[model samples]
Target chain A: MTGPGRPAAVTGIGLAVSGLGTPDDLLQPDGAEEAFDPATGLTGRAMRHKDRASRFALRAAADALRDAGLLTGATFAGPASRTCVVVSTNFGNLDSVCTFADTIAEDSVLGLSPLGLPHTSSNSVAGWLAIEYGLRGPNLTVCNGGTGGLDALFWARAMIAADRADVALVVGVEPDTAPVARLVGHRPRLDGAAAVVLESVPHRRSRGAPPRAVITACTHGAALPDAVRAVRGTDRQPVGLWLTPAGPRPGDAASSWCATTRDLTARLGECSGALGVLQCVAGVSYLDASGPGAVLATSADGPDHTAVAALLLTAPGQAS
Target chain B: MSCVITGMGAVAAVGGGPEQIFTALCAGTSGLTKLRAFDLNRYRAHHAYEIDDRTGPGRDEPLRATRWLVDAVEQACADGGLTPAARVPVLLGTTLREQRSVELWWRGEGEVSAADLHFGPALRRRFGFTRTYTFANACAATLYALGLATDLLDLGMADAVVVAGTDAITESAFGTLDRVQNRTPEALRPFDRARAGMLMGEGASAVVVRRDGDGDRPALARIRGVSMNCDAYHPTAPDPAGIAAAMHAAHTRAGLGPDEIDLVMLHGSGTELNDAAEATALHAVFGDAAARPLMTAIKSMTGHTLGGSGLLSLIVAVLSLHRGVVPPIAGLTDPADEAAGLRLVSGTAATAPLRTAQVDAFGFGGINAVAVVERS
Candidate 1:
């Protein structure tokens, strides 16, 4: 819906993490507990079989929709068929799969629950979000390591750019269960979900909805800095802030071109797949409080950092 | 922008490569036999379409599906004559990713990590790819990835892209199916009046897609259009309306009418609801056309290959368009009442002059995807 130079707008943002309730909470470090219940905010039927990661996703999705003024009570008031859902997570369903396999191993085929079968699928989170909200547009799930969150956002932007949908709901979530902890060892794990609502400029304007920030570019490259450079291409417009997975260090190269750099992982436990969306959410909160400025969010795929992705966003009225 | 398929590779229960699998299908060879991947002493279902350990990556491998994935990608690159320096972006799709290895690890027999559950690092290490995406959209994942690959090419993101899917049978999936089926089916028989349920299979498939005239490589087929959507209705039940909408959208985007399609690779999982729902959707889309497309279900021989089934079907569709041969849905005798008006290939392979063909794939959680491929 945006022209070549025009940018898509982020109308709303939502987050659901242990001991944290909002995006602004990330700025102030608070001790997070090991367990957080997501059932308090979830309403409606057929949610009994939803896995932990899916529950976090549903809660975050609901909050995002409400923030966007597209949802009230338990019903969505927007154009359901014109909205799409994309989810990103690497080990969201590992616990469920392991439990199901245990049931089969111990009790044979008879012990398998019919309802439990669907939860083993990695896309169950996206599917449940769609079924709960009746979003019939394109549905996708990404599990491509650390850059997965950025990849999800890129696809959402791509869908809107190609006119496949007018609005896109992008979610990133991960579960820290017994099996996941055993597999990942002592690495920082994500225990909740983060979501962003992206809408075309025309669609946002037609609905008279205010934009928190506008996304100018999203891309994938071989490295995080290169990805940011690719998106910022040939432009001398200085970046106001850089939100990265790793914390900012002294004499950081990003400091030369960006006003400030904030470490997402330092504030919000290493989120892995949720890092990108959380970065965008943090960027939006910063721009909302700091006035017109540009923010660059970047993440890498694995320890090798061979694959990376970046997203560039600016305040509502700032030039891209 | 027009995206064309420059190369394809596949590894199914019946054979190891696209050409060998196609030839075996044409000869009515089925891979269904006693389930040997695991102990079946307490299970009701005794048979499945499984790849032989000797022919596959061996039974002791940590992750059999990853090996298959590597082989398929290597074959695809070789077929396309693409060097490792090309650095093609990869888009991978799967339902159960490395779950078999996880199952082994759970049983205290193998070692598996969080990294083993994904394919990005392995792919990059093997092919030096800098950009790769993994889509876990259930059985329809491959088609969903294919659609995104086309989008990447259309946007000029890369000169070439590799769309792939891989998965192995897991104890969880097999047990779930075994408990859900009313009666354990001895063999998968799609579209038959006596169809019972689906049998699980394992394998991997890949296709290299490039913009038309991107290189000197010969194009195997042109990907006209790909459409994906979610039913948002039920988790396991296939929605006829959603399937029909995807098919209609694919045809509309391809700039072709329903009559233009000469063949259709049906998502025939041999399940009662899936077959009936697919047929209903097909009838709704075609609507009394004089010459509707000839429908074929390779799962009759390959078994339901889960995640990789969609790309496997696309590869077969391309071969059919090139060779003018349509493999029959083996074991199907009498068509069901829901499939009465449709023309289904059965008993033996059919010969036809095909130009345009469509591949259908639907997954758990109501995901649906359809792709139209044609000989340009």
Candidate 2:
């Protein structure tokens, strides 16, 4: 693998999970609730036929821009052409897909709503995020396995490094609907969204936004140890903390490499698409509260997921 | 570092491989026929460009798109003369991925797991690819995936990447298209004066991309650049300004001017709005150039393969650049008024000393993606 490019600064964070007061709540031992209502703060006739995941995405994106000091009221404060959006959701729009299928089965082809058709397209969340905030730069949707969240963040970092965009609004959301439950066997999953404003150093500095954390490296590989090794590269200093999908096992190689390890899945339930962003938010919080440390975020390995994506986060102005 | 396509493969209604598809296009073959995926009764549109039973009949065996994808990827690997490596990443772009399988399960006609909705599980099991990324970026998904694949190579994340797009005709998308079009033409006639609307098609296309100097394989074509953007306009409507922006970005990144482009593969979904809007955008982008490129749409023959359409067009563009010939837009009785200044190839394949080409894919939600390719 090539050497890591210039670090990307995390300037803002947004959360829309049910019963969480803020992103910091993710660090708690338990969550408030397991279910979310899509109509909590979404209003107006524009949201008439919007799906639950799209609504969560819009809410989290707006909050992220606002948190980044790039949005005032309903207007975006940054250059629209240079700002992009990258969204991650494994099963975000299952409800809409199933609903449309049922509609066709119950009635006929003509019975389907034309307005509802766009949501069935998997990119609707990213499209809606861009349209709502007028982000005209590159737009993409990552719908892979559990690694999708980190994949989305890695894409944003790659885009910024390639000069495709100066700022990337990365959002990961998955809804807990009946159709999704039926397909996945009702395993408790996060029914909300988590977002982060990842920007180039110059862009963040120009806006005078304080960096919450700096992503020194992001790598994807066949396994977690290899990915973590790639992230660390030749740097021998062990990471201070590791926020992983599941807690470290007794014989895990990472536990010996890092000082502390926390299971994000156990603490926050099944975050799924929101896992990577939540890990970043928690990393920022940990660095802000403590001082001078690195946090590596990773997803759990599964038979369906043959890949592992890792993100290395360090405190502002600190080496990873 | 420059990215080049080492090998390419495609599976459409008209043909199975790149050479076969290109030959079929040069022969003005059309793949449109009566819709056999579902009951056509009570529907105004009764036709679609569908693959035959070679992959098995529709609905009876779900994951039809996955089958096509696997076939295309295997062909691409063989074409490149490269063995599957553990580090090779598979980047797949799809709209309605295996949603057809989900639909079958919803109707109690098949068994599908949540993991089966994507191609990762199937691909991992078959090829043992370590990392696979699936992008469901609507119709423009394939080109979008190409952009990421190029990035992965540039970033040294992988030695090479397998970029593929696959989609089967799903009932929901078909019903939605039927409702939106009101009536589907017997054949999709993109840019035609009497063109009605687009018909859904099923197929898969793949290309193995790597840094030019990284491997010893002969390069089929050089990928100059791939760019994508959101119109941030209406969800289902085409935006000329947005489309033009993506085209300009692609050209700028490729370091090529509009005059240098010899051919363009239009999105050309055969819909009235798409045709007019795409033509307008092309004019806006190439307005200052002295000679406009010869533009053609393969969807007129292959039909709209949705997510697979972009790479399908790109594969054809690569062949055109290599062969120095352009395929005709099949069944074009008369061109529309908006295509007045555009040089659209019709009737039969035309020869030109082509050096560079551009492929455009504009999708729902105003997602626009463009890619520039050149002869190796």
Candidate 3:
């Protein structure tokens, strides 16, 4: 197992749950909410150019960066040289892709939108973020299913620990469309997106950043043996906040810390790939107000099951 | 903690499984054929390395691409002597999802499944796998999967991780190639003077990576090092600096020098930009040296499988290292002016016992992945 690197600081966040608009919205998840708009500040040609998924991603990144005080006036003032960009997306801009393909099919090969083809790639959102912010370190785009969001978090932390980057911007995004909705089985009221900024403890201290949550430890295992051991060292807990696609899939290794495992399926309906990050956001907010929370994300409903567990520890003097 | 390739499987345009594909490569057989999967009458290019299903009545239960994935895994499991549990971790890469719905969904013929968009979860359910990863970095997809497999094995997350990649030629990709970019001419002839472009190929290839102590079977090769990095340059075109950085990182991680690379697997997509970009990156890494490790190109034989291309080349590399031969580049008249500086393997298979082999794949989205394997 790799050494748990210096605690990466989650200093900023941009949440886009369907019913709830922000992390504050997550705290009071009453079935009532306002219309979701990630394209608020981002306008003009860039907005016109990006598809829904990319727009959602850009909005989150911009908001998280703003929350982190990395913005200088209207631009990001953080050290772009070392800030890594990671975007976790499931389908990518499949709507534009389908439409692009439709044009080619209805017309010919030349019947293509040169502007649309690049955005059709699975990594387009990540690439656009990198280009938008000029982040040059490692522009990683992961495409795992429900765990992709947490996997991006795990990877971002590892990079920080390995001295791969000084700062990381990770966004978990999934846009809903007729095609994507049919694939994942449920459509959400709004496309989901969440962004969190992770800075090295050293970088955070240097910036005198006021961090919200400290990721004490984050890991994934093929077997549950290591996780049980890791949990034994944590505060005694119930299923504090369970984050499942529906009522937990059969093979999910429900954490010992969960109190009331929250069912996202019925509340927010089902989201495509943004579920993991949304869960992480909720976990962070829960830890901030409630107590220590564990996110148990499972993806073995088919047969061969794999579970990724992430622990959110309240900062020193957080709460009981 | 050494990572070894105990078993490998493939369903390529040239042949099925590694042994057959290796044999076909040695025979210099071309698999490029007329595009009959559907029909391409109006297009200027009417051929690709597409697999034609002439034997079986079109059965549509599980996806055809997913079937290839499972078959390749079965072959790898058999070779490794592994009865993988119900939850073996799987990592797959491909540019396009199983295209069952590409036409069907568009024309109101069939509905799209989770398999078409998010293939990992669908395959994970189909195979009953616990942990699964899908890397879609165009041509470099499987190499990315291979690198992640090494990480899972190194971290002891799983004793064995399935690293596979597959792509079925569809109107989405073929349409793009036929009209947008890298238009194919007959077949792929990469790094050659008479290069036309790359033909879209359909394939699914897998490698079983196990911790050194997982099995008693002899390892085919050892993964000494692997690196994945993106070119922050353009979306489609590759940045030489980005490609070189990835190659250098792979070398450093492998603890090998440029000279240690006994055999080099070129990304050679048979396109002008891809081939030129690859050559520039290689020149930066290896420089002008006559006695550099002998180089070989495989897409000419296997066709560019997009997401499956890198893994197909990797499967070929493992076979080459294990069998001690580099397959010839078919349909070659002369080397391109830019590639003239690089050593090309042609005419017949070269039998040079190689110690270290470095396989490279540069995908469309500017993702460059490199892996170095040594004869185990």
lDDT of each: 0.84, 0.84, 0.70
Candidate 1's docking class is medium
Query: Which residue segments of model 3 deviate by more than 4 Å?
Result: A1-7, A16-20, A30-42, A69-84, A137-139, A158-167, A181-189, A199-208, A216-240, A249-267, A289-320, B54-62, B99-103, B120-127, B182-184
Positional deviation of residue B273's Cα in model 3 after best superposition, in angstroms: 1.3
lDDT of candidate 3 over B268-370, digit per residue (tens): 8888887788788888887754248878888888788777777788878888887889998888778888877666788888998888888888875577789
Candidate 3 residue-wise lDDT at A246: 54
Candidate 2 or 1, higher DockQ: 2
Evaluated at residue B43, the lDDT of candidate 1 is 83
For all predicted structures, in order, the TM-scores are: 0.95, 0.96, 0.88
lDDT by residue for model 3 (A92-143), tens: 6667666765776577666765566565456778777776776756666777
State the TM-score of the second chain for every model: 0.97, 0.97, 0.93
lDDT of 1 at B298: 96
Fnat of the models, one by one? 0.65, 0.68, 0.26
Question: Higher-TM-score candidate among 1 and 3?
Answer: 1
Error of 3 at B153 (Å): 2.9
* Candidate 1 regions with alpha-carbon error over 4 angstroms: A1-6, A31-46, A247-251, A318-320, B54-61, B85-87
DockQ of each: 0.58, 0.64, 0.36
